[model samples]
Target: MSDTYRALTRKYRPTSFEDIVSQDHVSNTIKNAIKQNRLSHAYMFCGPRGVGKTTMARVLARTINEIDSSIDGESLNQTLNIVEMDAASNNKVDDVHHLRESVRIPPQNGKYKVFIVDEVHMLSKAAFNALLKTLEEPPEHAIFIFATTEPHKVLPTILSRVQRFDFKRISVDEIVQRLRKISLDEDISIDEESLHVIAKKADGALRDALGLMDQAIAFCGDTITHNELLQALNVVGTDRLFEFMECVKDHDADRGLELINTLLQEGYDIQEYLIGLTEHLRNLYIAHETSKLYLVEASEETKKRYQQTAGDFSRDDLMRMLHIISEAQIKLKDASQPRIQFEITLLKLIHMERSEQLSELLAGLQELKKNSGNFVAPSQNGSTQKEVKPEPEEQAEKVSEPVDETESTEENLEPQPLNPSTDSEAVGSDGSSPGPKESEIEVEAEAEVDTQIEEEEDDDFDIGAPALITTLARKARASVQSEKQKQTAPSNGAPTETSSEKDLPEKITTEYVQEIWVEYLESLKGDFPMLLHLQMERTKVKKVKGGELHLECDNSFAQKMLDEQSTDLQFKLKEFTGSVLRFNISVGEIDEKDKPMSVYERFKQIQQKDPIIRDIVEIFGAELEY
Candidate 1:
């Protein structure tokens, strides 16, 4: 007869409390209970599959029944008193009655009779009720132990009667350590990286680790490398997945799609590949913020890879990618062609750019303020102050003194004028030299003071009008342009010129046309928020062209919404502008660079010949949709 090989997982199954891996707390607690003579009549163990819950239960049975422990040549045989049942297949009321009857009589030789039921939650309601009476009040010598992966499905009455212990998922490190020991004892040669892969593939299950290791050894002829492990499990390695993620981050859609196609050609499951990629990204996210990378349950090399990859992405980008992948997962299941779904999802990820961080936006604003000199400091009177310094020539002209002719005139005045001299003498007194008059000096001082005050007031008004308008326009334009760039930059650098042109109308400033468009937009006050908001932001009157009034909005959604309500909008605009204006909606995002100066600034800059936007800034803070 030919000898058969036992699987490593079954051959190395935990037989004693000390042999169970990654479950010291549970095993130690059970051991102490036995030692203290405080064992419960009914015990429940619940956790994920292969975490040693059932194994612990079996060990408990053997311990209580006093079965021989001869694995390590330490025999402690006393008597057999434990019976095990698979409740999944035998969940009938009759089965429960049979079990109850069997537990009635005491063990033939042992002190306690133990019954171990695996998957106890699978028992039908009738079976559970049938077993309840015996479970609640069993004989002093009887013990009932139940194990289940899902404890919520178990009857509450049965649960209330039993002492429950919840089990935890094993860490990857624990699984790796157990596999290393097995490899050593079994004389199988495998690299640390291969062991890491197997452990991760096991996903917090020691038994699963053993099983995978057994399979790896068998398939790879006793020596397993990282590549061998990957082939055996069909896993795309961490490095390739990270490369794919990098491509996505860089907006390289072609490269990302190529990677997906390559993996699919390698016989990997599309869904499983996506799921693994999602997990890889999640780990990277966790690693980005944490110094304790080891706690992520990856090998040293894998942890390093994660840390390096995490440095390439912002947290927001990683989160966005995770969301996209998750949504793709749902769509792929019912998709007509799963591969196409994956391709489309990959393209989306690769072409996706992270939204500008609010910090970056604020920083840009600060930079613009520094460049444009728009910041105004508040004055003592609570009004804003603007400092102005005149040119050297202008200053010289302002502070120059008037000629001093008063002294000359006084020298020419005759002494007879003091004694009320003749009329001829008084009239001829200043003929040779004129004397200064008090009224003339006073008039000159008052005129100079008035001129200085007027100049100061004009400077303040000049800064206030144009500066305020320019500041508002620049901000509005920057916000709109940034958003537009984000939306269009990933689409091969093609600007949305068509959409921009469609939203702008030519020569729509005539009073008749202006009134018509205003009435049209106002009519949509209740019907469309986007149109209303757009109108609120737009105040300039563009000249009408081809009987159409053009207006700009911040985004495409607003543009589309306005387009849908064009007819009603056109009629109202005609009424307000006094022209039969058709609608030409220009969805041009703001151009920060081309924004005109404020009205006040423009007036001051008449010498500079800079034109100002000829309208008030429209302010609409309310939420609107078009």
Candidate 2:
């Protein structure tokens, strides 16, 4: 190493506020404080490393003492009164005590004594406590500036005593500009792309950026190229990134996996590769999302390349790729076989489009199945075709034909409810109260109506177009009543009756209904499979009172489904119970703990009550955090 050699970080470190990039806020505040002589005795500088935290503290020390223009670089660092302490090394209670003892002494030459402590958060609990009192009430001539990456780790007591200035990360443009200026001033030959690579490698740390540039210059001799800088830094090339993305676009998982193996063979970090891929996908997503390139932090050529590839993917496909990579990265930490896990996740991306297509096809089939049951669907080649128009004039004539006394044409205008407990008992035309004989006549009439309706129903029927079905059902019900009157019209001026309750099942009850419910559910399993997701597995038959059986479901959604299917469900129940039982469905309250709260539901509740949070939601387009 040459004796006169100096690292670029030390040589080009900002000496004045104007020289610091992207730190106008910090610089402006400190300048006003020093100029006005209103500086705090204890001040805290907090931010990420190499964003002018320590450098700002040093500049403040010299400027406050009015020695900034007089002191040279090497001598300024070794000055007596302007003491700089590395808190990482001298963080014990004794070191703090010794400093505390020395704080009482006045400056030998300068008007003020300045002590700058860097990484002050590294001090022990005892050291902080010992320094707290001194920090609160320091000597008038002594100015203490504490610099820390983590201001939160410092005691609140210490923080309260000092005026804290929080520094922000320098922007990429600013960092790049700084690197360019340094390269020009130092007579180094490097392209803009190489400087950007160094700036990105620095990650907002100007010290790190200059250090990287110094290393690049040393390695490349004089002219630093992008490829040499990438090799020197051991980062994967843009070519590899593009190639990997192309493999995905072509849906070639085998080639992608081979590329991954090659990267591993070259001793590249899996995590780096994963991050690089995620960033590339993010750039592509941005390109697809907007016409503006403000958000993208890459060269014009790189942006054009991303733009070219961006159209090759949809937003959904890009989001899926991002999700897969993010999940893999999270799982990669605890994974014993990280490489295998990565391979699986990448292969999942390759197969994602096909899987989504299959999902859509299955969904369509399910929807068709649901609606097909409601209609007499068309057959291929117009097979099973039927023209359901019967002769209207003949039907009207038959309807207008008067019936003889032997067969009563009494039309039951309003159909009686088919509830076993209170079904209308067929009475005589003379207004005789209904008895077992009348009930038997009604039962026989209903059976005949069922058979007649079945023979007329054809494949052209549409339930959604319900005019025909509704008319048919009404006509079937009217025919039953007319038949009931015929049976009870009295043969030879005397009504005839048949066998009664012995032909049907005895007494309908809630207990009997409950017994057959499980069997009914089992029958439904072949049809409405979505009902299996229902939480109300144990629906209770509350009672059979007032002509209706009351059933209670534990969930409102389940109750609604049951109510909608009540006609079909009650039919099944009656087939087992042997009675025309009516039903009233209700939802009962379940335990609050049993009904688990979702984060979204809670967020909705909160949003309803808190208008400020609602406004924040509207302003930011923020969703509920899980």
Top of the candidates by lDDT: 2
- The lDDT per prediction is 0.67, 0.70
lDDT of 2 by residue, 412-474 (tens): 222444447644445567776444343434444444443344444454343322212224444
Model 2 residue runs over 4 Å out of place are 1-3, 68-74, 354-363, 370-626
Model 1 residue 101 distance off true place after TM-score fit, in angstroms? 1.4
What TM-score does prediction 2 earn?
Answer: 0.59
Query: Which consecutive 10 residues in model 1 have the weakest lDDT in total?
Result: 617-626
lDDT of 2 at 478: 48
Cα deviation of 199, candidate 2, in Å: 1.7
Task: List candidate 1 segments past 4 Å from native.
Answer: 1-3, 71-80, 355-626
In order of listing, the candidates' clash counts read 36, 2
